[model samples]
Target chain A: MPKEYDTFVDDLSTLPEGKELILAIRDLAPGNRKYDTRVVKAILASSANKLPEGDILWLRYQRGSLRPEPWRIKIIDEREGLLLKEKVYDT
Target chain B: MPFRDNREYIEALEKAGEVVRVAQEVDWDLEAGAIIRRSYELKLPAPFFQKIKGYPKGFRMFGGPLANFRRLAIAMDMPADSHPGAILDEYHKRAQHPIKPVIVKDGPCKENVRIGDQVDLYELPAPMVHDGDGGRYISTWHFVLTKDMDSDWVNWGMYRQMIHNSRDMGGLFLPTQDIGVMYYRKYEANNIPMPFATAIGPDPISALASCASYGVGRNEADLAGGIRRAPVELIKCETSDILVPAHAEIIIEGEVLPYKRVDEGPFGEYTGYRSSPRMPRPVYRVKAITFRNDPILTVANMGVPLDDADICLSVCGRTDIKTILDNYGFPITGIHLPPECSGHMIVVAVQAKYTNIASHIANAIWGTKLPYPYIVVVDSDVDPYNITEVLHAIVTKCHPVRGIRAQEFAVGHPLLPFLSLEERMWGKGAAVLLDCTWPLDWPKEIAIPRKASFKEIYPKEIQEKVLNNWKNYGYK
Candidate 1:
């Protein structure tokens, strides 16, 4: 089974990476989730002085310890609501 | 734009070119109030004071934060011009499904720490936001903590804290509020002081949530988690068992002595008037302080429209009123937290699915948790956000005795100006529940024919062309 995060350091950096990656883990969290990713793209676009819909992934961090990875993950868009979800794949 | 904290929020505004930073030093006295008032009158975004007349260079101040409902909406991660009704609906929905806060050991807020004797309140440029104020108030945006009398669940609320001295602070102890009631009960049983902590500049959403009058026993921090979706990161206080935002700018850990009370305010309030005269209130004794480097202080201007007092408190009242009514199963169609009355007046629009729906909604709203609502419920189509429409429903649809209900001796909001006007003014007033639903026997459809209009037979392209080229007709 996939590992769960027991510490803060692991939780912050374990966020899903991009669109394809986020789709796999959307419904694992117990509460409703809202994903806000505009800034990731906006910051990237602003730095380049051009708008290109920069890539920033969003996902819901579900409840449950990482050693057993009991929760699922839900991806969402601020403007569009829910995007996708994926079951925690065991190692 | 998204922000990690108040400092980060301001930084985002500056980066987006939405804010104008004043480099020149401005006095924290009346001068700051004047500048803030001018910003509101001009409908400009709030200003950031990089340099104040007093205090160290790194001590920054923010004024007029969330002065407008639109701005408050933006802070809640909604569109700039979103209506209060829409925002509150979302708030209620989020409250039911809460995301727990994440516990973190360290963050940027720990960059600098001040504990014990080194902690000096005078070092920060906390502004005397209003004239004739007791002293430079520090609690405009601070969260005051008190645990539930029965449960250990912590209660966080944005009650105003006034700076009396480096070691002492005084705050309102209104008997109606949860904090006041809880503290009094503890004092009565223990016959000793109750320890409390005041946190300044936590995450913006958390600060906003604290201002909301969530029902007793429910932790406002959970509401903050709901607002953010992701769990809010929290850190335990160094001096007390209380938990504060890991990223908060400053935390003042203190206790309120059971028998001690001091003169707190003659300060201007949200009702567009200064409270009659000075009065003694409960005092908070500072025992420890923890802060980050170059900490930024936030202030809310009182005594005028669309200031932080209104924006923040209004959201609280609005959310509380709606939540209470919804909890009672009232078919509420909409609710408005008008900036005009500093959110004291609440107008609810109900669908009125059946007869007496208006009266039920009105009574439900009036009897709800937030004490006095000054409620007016109209037909769903009336659009409660439109002052003109709400008034029209009250005037045309409501028959005085049939629609209105009066409540006497009900507790009033302390900030209400009318309270201080008369000798022992009734701390209460009558609430009108306009029965705007059509007469009981009336048919649903209107019998009259449609009025004539120019667009009846016009094609879409032709209508658009006429509108676009209207000036060419020389109508002027």
Candidate 2:
């Protein structure tokens, strides 16, 4: 099967530049997610290296919904600026 | 205990850690509006801009002066952390006693005076409060003072005024409003210019009193004096016979000429909508401008809830409704007009002794001077201040078909966005009454269900334990 969408890439810079990204942070986080581009750009410009494993970053160009349902992601493992993870679903 | 003037109120706010000063250069254009809007959204302290971009250092603009309950409490001379209900109770208790004002020879407002050609309206840093506003408004928080031709009754009213040029401004003067339009009609009959004086920053309590629903031919200055429990000091205006607060920060003396109309409005009103269109209205000709050195301009930022207008108007509405209901001998427990509704919704809690008691109170409210169109009558058990409890009462006790009543034709506020074109134009609207109380004639065997609540369901000891351990359970 194609690499699962939950699989995290190494450095955030390694991900395809134009692909959509989604932030799975708490509801009380500062800054609005409606302007996804600015949020992604700010994240990339930060000093953090590896993506939190299982975190899904949806780029603006890829999403159709203005405000999508909130998604939860959990980090599994990190090695050499890379993150490997899996999505957890409730039964 | 009452503030003598606006300066005293500002100093009190500053001492209470409720004033924020900005020294950076800011534009009087959209930038100032945006900053004030953001501050209000954040529920921060009142902002005082000391350095407007084009204006000099002495000139200042204050935004969201009474945004927080703590600030309002201080302005009313109550303890800083007093509850809103207590403040209203105090105001109502004081309003019953009327104290007349004392006129003095001179005060700080006369430190500098400009008359004739020296008068310039553009010198003051009036801000464009919203992007879609028609123009910069200068008299958002101030009161326009006018007197009747045949009587000595002086009226203080809050009306929006737009700056048009160096010496002239335009404003809306609805004929139904007590002071401006009514006075203009009397002047029109005699064919004379109606003398008027506007005070920019007077004592905060006096400004609050202007928003009350006192009947026509009653002097608001006297009512303000009653509320303050001390006589207000009045001084003569330069160009008119009108009297203004002696200690006001700035005063503008002028006249409203009969048969003269100019274009005004599209300004965002307290209804949270820019519903009013630009149309021809009365023009105010400026004859004299008086102020203290480096006077501060107070602006009420409109278009959103929890602003100065919402707080003051709601307090005034609650006090007036309570006093009216008490005079009628209705068993009233509480009255409240939530700020978020912008004076459109009124909630009354009462102990109903008869079947139609709720309906009677609602109809009486409709007949009052308050302009709210939606009213909710809840039983004494429900807390009028708690929106969730009121909603629960409506959902559980009210029957959709039997408990609701509607008055097809009632006086509607023109600024309400939901009104039709005809209703807005004619100033006529409908009123709805929601009776959220149980039927008194229900069978005794079919007992009313008890409310399922923590205090109702749990044992007394358990409830007391939970309450005492609330902080320990990490429920801040």
Candidate 3:
């Protein structure tokens, strides 16, 4: 059976403020040559205390990369209440 | 102050601390080309090669002549730190007043002259620019002067010339360009060889004017004169009636054979790709060569982004498009053709008062002389020069289905690498229009949303306070 994941992040409230975050999506399944792993970076604005739900975060897929897949977000690093780094896993 | 000649311009650059003198002997084959390319990629100072492997002491090569923005700013008689918008404004302001050329009896270009059997092009150390180039090119930064047979109007254009032999060179004259339509077409239809003169290193203003897309019958000599705020002094060619810059470093008088065609290209073009295939094009037969004592050859190494060609195209394209839109009474805020796209994409910021104004602007841009295939129109609030802001507008305001339009058949530049061999051969292509503006039919509440920006959400006092105390708040 193929592993499945969510394509969208349900909660972005956990992301720290005033820090840069890299939303990395990786393909975990082996022998899938067509799928591509990529990452995009965005900063959490300090002025905004909270991120509204359903707010869209545009992602760019590389040419010949896999289409949108199930993914989960993770806080890779946090410093001084600022979101420093992040990664998303997709199976 | 206006530069008297190419040498004077180089001197000014050196005095301004924007040029580097490379005294070490470098081979013309690839060593010189690699150095020039690397300098452009790294945004280094212009390289002045004083010693080429086979050339003599006086023979020199200046590479990436206009790659630096500050260098371009200095060339146009502006401040070294002048912004891109200021440079474009200066060009537009000067273009309104054209000063004609004044013919002179003689100049430095005539210090040495060779005709017939004595003329040898190989003596000049022309660098083999790219590794995939078909041959060494001697005319990348040079301007070709041609005149219509029936009309007195003269046209100056920058066209690449590849060295074919000791006396012959191959080049391209696309039918859509002003030079091909106004001058070459007339000669080709009549089966008569067109008289031409190639100015190797004219003043910097003349070189800039040569790359611009001035309308048909527009004389670039006058434009150069206008940009310099003085009439350019011209000296008549030895074998042709076409006049060239009197203070030019080197001038070659030649005749472009209308009936003759020679194989040229498969070289790397300004599009950041090696897309042009080897094909037969017009050949220029050298009849006379003249130059000053120990003339310097100016070369522009074209391949990737941030090169001299990108600088020229961005400045010229922006000025040309802005002038066109303004003349048509469009309330345009700003226009920019980013150099990263190699003049293929244009971003226009305009004030929309009526319905579908963005769509109208996009269509109008397509009809202009610009070679761009993709155009994006944004609201006045958006900054077209800022790529990130423009992309955000495209993402938020644009509807992928309704706001995007495509034309199946559009005039395309022959040098565009993305086109297939058949499409390029037929000179047929497509153009796209992207409108990144709010819909006019929607109500204010529906069309507008609260922006998540500091200036938009926060009160003016709080925003100002935060900005004023930014440095004190541990923000460097």
* Candidate 1 chain B weakest ten by summed lDDT: B421-430
Misplaced by over 4 Å in model 1 are A1-91, B15-17, B79-86, B400-402, B420-435, B441-476
**DockQ for each model:** 0.01, 0.01, 0.01
lDDT winner: 3
Better of 2 and 3 by lDDT: 3
Misplaced by over 4 Å in model 3 are A1-91, B471-476
Residues B1-476, model 1: lDDT tens digits: 33568876676555544467888988776677678777876778788888877566877777776777666666667776676777767766776777777788887666766677876666666676764455567777768877665687778887787766556677775655678777766663576677787878777788888887776777887888888676777787767777778888888887777666554555677777764334446778787787778887777777668677777766677777777777877777887767776766778787677777766776666665455546676767777778887777777777777766656555565456655433112234334444655555565457322223456457779889989889898864
Off by over 4 Å in 2: A1-91, B444-447, B458-476
lDDT over C-alpha atoms for residue A31 of model 2:
22
In model 2, how large is the Cα lDDT of residue B419?
83
lDDT of 2 at B345: 87
Clash number for candidate 2: 8
**Cα deviation of B68, candidate 3, in Å:** 2.6
Tens-place lDDT per residue, model 2, A1-91, is: 1111111122346443333443221112212111111111112212113333333432211111112222223333222211111311100
- TM-score of structure candidate 3: 0.82
At residue A67, give the lDDT of candidate 2.
Answer: 20
